[model samples]
Target: MLNSIGIPGLIIILVIILIIFGPSKLPKLGRSIGESLKNFKDSTKDVIIDEEDEKKEQKQ
Candidate 1:
């Protein structure tokens, strides 16, 4: 679904976000989003490692 948005669509979305949040808040919002994504990725990686360990244990 997101693939179809293209560059123009992204620009429009960013413009709307900027209008709503303003330039000063944009950096803060971006930082929060980045942190959220990082946490999500770390959690997923941990889950994957746990699953792999369980699979290895089952194979023994």
Candidate 2:
């Protein structure tokens, strides 16, 4: 859905977001997004590792 937005459309969207969030808030917003993504990755990694260990234990 988002890919349907061409280059110009993407640029327009970015501009709008910048206008709404402003430069000062942009850094904080980006940091929050990054941290959220990192947390999600770490949690998912833990779940995957736990599942693997469980499977290994079952085989043994």
Candidate 3:
């Protein structure tokens, strides 16, 4: 869905968000989002490793 937005569409969306959130809030929002994404990525990696370990044990 987002892939269809293209560069111009992204620029427009960013501008709208900037207008709504203002500059001061943008940094905080970005930092929070970054942290959330990082945590999600780490959790997913842990889940994948656990699944692989289970499979290995089952094959033994």
What lDDT, from 0 to 1, does candidate 1 have?
A: 0.99
- Please, what are the lDDT tens digits per residue for candidate 3 over residues 1-60? 988999999999999999999999999999999999999999999999999999999999
* Clashing residue pairs found in predicted model 2: none
When sorted by lDDT, best at the front, the candidate numbers are: 1, 3, 2
Best by lDDT: 1
TM-score of each: 0.95, 0.84, 0.93
The better-scoring model by TM-score among 1 and 2 is 1
Better of 2 and 3 by lDDT: 3
Clashes of 3: 0
Candidate 3 lDDT trough over 10 residues, lowest sum: 2-11
Give the winner by TM-score: 1
Q: Where does candidate 3 clash, by residue pair?
A: none
Q: RMSD, each candidate, Å? A: 0.6, 1.3, 0.8
